[model samples]
Target chain A: MNAPLPAAVDWPLAVHQALSRLGFGVIGYVPDAGHKRLIELCHGDARLRTVVLSTEEEGIGLATGAWLGGAKTALLMQSSGVGNIVNALGVVRECRIPLLLVVTMRGEYGEFNPWQVPMGQATPEVLRAMGVLVQRADTADEVAVQVDAAARIAFGGYAAAAVLISQRVIGIKSFQEQAAQ
Target chain B: MSALRRREVVRALLVNRGDLLVVAGLGSTAWDCAATGDHPLTFPMWGGMGCAAVTGLGLALAQPARRVLVVTGDGEMLMGLGSLATIGVQRPANLSVVVIDNERYGETGMQKTHTAHGVDLAAMARAAGFASAVLVREASAIESLRQAVHHGAGPHFAQVKVVAEKEAITLPPREGTLLKNRFREALLGASASLQ
Candidate 1:
């Protein structure tokens, strides 16, 4: 078990550290602002290989392939992206591939975009419906902890698992946020 | 004179394949691979329609030293078309994607795929920046295809044009987990678990 993290923690860094320590070779993503820091951390570290996917579903396939080839992998995506992997997740469930997903929420808690609601609201149940074990981390302190646990369970049990980092933790994206930058 | 037979093309590709790891796409390609005498190194997709190429990409990325081949159908390839862009970017030299383009969805009542009309998958692969991409319409070219798959510096893509027809069912083990476990064991030996 990993030692308890400090109260004042950079959750992204914490999650990155946990994954690195667990020996994940590949990090697949569709690029999400919520996971920006963690993605950068994995990319910067030589220990991990970063694959920027065209869509979220590719990450699951990537993870499955990497695992079958004897290397561990994880995926990073936004909550709405979860809907994209609904059918593809079958490969993991049927094959018993160990997949760890770190998703940033979009629809709930100070949400600005109406389009994100349907899929984002359906994320957890959708994942559960696909036979994936779901874990939620609504706060920074819980983020790394959930990731660590989820990854352990996924790999250790050879099952599909996900850690959903609440949008409250990722912070809602305002329309003007990027325009100002 | 005509498109190739998928089973024959798959058999030609697998002849004395040695240690090459294959990620067989769902439906006919999986059945085609199984038809060639199932091997522990081959993971035939029971589901996940468009995942074949990226799965091969993942395997290629993971096992850099081992040659990885993805054999999928035209429809499966078309569905995961974006993966060509993704693969083109990473460009794992050991990976090769072979599309069995009969230009029809064989399992789904032989509906015409985009290739049956005008879409050129090989051209799409070329545009995606694959190191080597071609459309193979002759069995005579398969010797070269085998060579490229077995011994080329490639993030290669080959669309072997096959005559779309119903093939006899050659089922591999239906249990997905066993297929995965045996493949990992064959590749990683005892270390499959530790990693």
Candidate 2:
């Protein structure tokens, strides 16, 4: 049956549900077509405020600011962008600020770009090496639950937590439909 | 330096339970994820230069009572050379910087760095007015870390020779806005508390 039509999954809705229950205030993200739907959900949700950034490292500065501002924040970036936030990891560790890192993975499954390979391979290793907790979801079915768990681990433990969303769960890049047209 | 030597130094320093340690660039390349506590905030935001010590300086300034330790790479240290003088002038007693020199940019495909020439980083720190500085090759990390942290004297700088590890591990894509929000939250929260 057309490979299950990719399940029309509500991954972002799940993310919203988890964040709401966890009381994570605002979310800062870089726009990625893979995350557009979730971005829209975060925009519509009253419990969270969304700030968009041009670069991943900007999210680091922003999140640090948010924490200083008395709001819990979450960073949503794709696999390649995490490379841009390595400095933030250094800053955060030094600042001793606790937050959540929600990473939507790219470059692993049927990746088209040669550039994505390096960051994709380094994501988990880098996170682990820095002592940031890492979690991965292989399918849309697991996104929200794992995100909730990661949130608890982050806030309750006061340490950085990461959630990795795989390409199979993210499915094909549908934004291509606009470019194709 | 062998992984064992690096670990020896890290373990020695980490024993000072409540202190904050920030590692920049590939200095964290082989770090043990489970080695942190409830308060450690590790920044791996960008794979670039000069950011580790700058961030460490900020933390030292913001939290004067908390000891802040930065593990930086030689390549990264070269990028932000000006911070040496800045740290000296600020004279934050809680700050200590340790540069791990592998003589190369171990992260981006093993390119050579200024450390290959054996530039005297400790002398540079001294010239910049740091109260204490030293250079220790591979076998001496354990003693150096112990001495640096124990002195509790002032802004301390040390260079540790390390052997580069050749391996590539992928990182997740950029979450630009999210990371900014998280950092902003931290800054704002701290400021709010002061008010």
Candidate 3:
């Protein structure tokens, strides 16, 4: 038999299964390369409904609505998208809605896109300021654990929680790399 | 066909609302909803101007057995215009969006919005792949719009044009948590506690 896939390659599946087990029926997101595999799994799952958002703030709204309707939901976004969600985060904080934000890091280590730096660097702080409990995971093995913790903090407590997956886990996509492709 | 009054349209829309859950955008639309008499089923945004439609989308998806209606003003709808594309693609049949288009930002001192400058929201909804979208400028059209809001096969969009006239504000509960808990209790009953 072929060798099992590496943990890095299998982490997306772990995250997906974790979300399903935690009872999240909806996944809302803006398109991001770092989340491609997770997004694909969300789309493929028969039990989950994937919502492609025009802006990340819309996902915040979706999460609030899902909570009121007694359904669980998660948001998957890139760090830059976190800036777009700041004002909308008020609903989650003030209303005490349970929210899970899975963010993929950029501009953290060996980042090529200069435009991503400001927001990426500010993401954790911004989320914290908005009253979101923040957790970081740098390796594939850490992802499932962090996600599980986040879900408990979010759903179990009716609070906002974020799991920021480091770029080291997603890999650095340099400008040169894109040009080569 | 002349534009219908905003308050009249809102009243008629909620006339036979039944078990429908309503999400109202900030400013005028929120006041309009409150004017209809507050209920636990109606969630009105006191802030977060552009979030109403997507909120309805989430409610629709979560409660497929229930109808979710979003009532928003023209300016608010313009601010969250991208949501139409998302809603169009998701196509939640139980959700409907109604834009009370006065063509001006009433809360911002009657500043003209994009709708006044030839931005057609109904057309945008149609182009974004909404199952059905219509612009209603006449009072006669309100009945058809009401039917669509309550019973139509939707993911529908209706732009109900109105005259830009200011009215006395009718405010809902200011506490977000209170409003949220009230709505949750109404919808989920004893299971409203988040834990």
Off by over 4 Å in 3: A1-9, A176-181
lDDT (Cα, 0-100) at B163 in candidate 2: 64
Scored against the native two-chain complex, candidate 1 gets a DockQ of 0.79
- For residues A1-181, could you state the per-residue lDDT of candidate 2 as single tens digits? 0111264457788788788887777677877666788888888887776766545665554455345445677878888888877755765665555678888877677665657778888999888777689999887878888898988887666568899988767655434642552
Question: How well is each residue in B1-195 modelled by candidate 2, as lDDT tens digits?
Answer: 344444445556666544354433433422421233212243344543465564565555555565666776788788777667656765668778887677877766778888787688889998987878877765645665666664576688887776665433444223433443443444444444332
DockQ of 3: 0.77
lDDT accuracy of residue B7 in candidate 3 = 93
TM-score of candidate 1 chain A against the true chain A = 0.93
Docking class of 1: medium
**In model 1, where do residues sit more than 4 Å from their true spots?**
A1-7, A178-181, B193-195
In candidate 1, what are the lDDT values of residues A1-181, reduced to their tens digit?
1112234679988998999899999999988887888888988999888999998888888988999888889999998899999999998998889999999988888677889888889999999999999999977888999999999999989888999988777665577773442
lDDT per prediction? 0.90, 0.65, 0.89
lDDT of 2 at A155: 67
TM-score of chain A of 2: 0.88
Q: Write the per-residue lDDT of candidate 1 for residues B1-195, one digit (tens) a residue.
A: 246888999999998999999999988999999999999999999889899999999999999999999999999999999999999999999999999999999888999999999799999999999999998888789999999999999999998888879999899887988999899999999778676
DockQ, each predicted model = 0.79, 0.05, 0.77
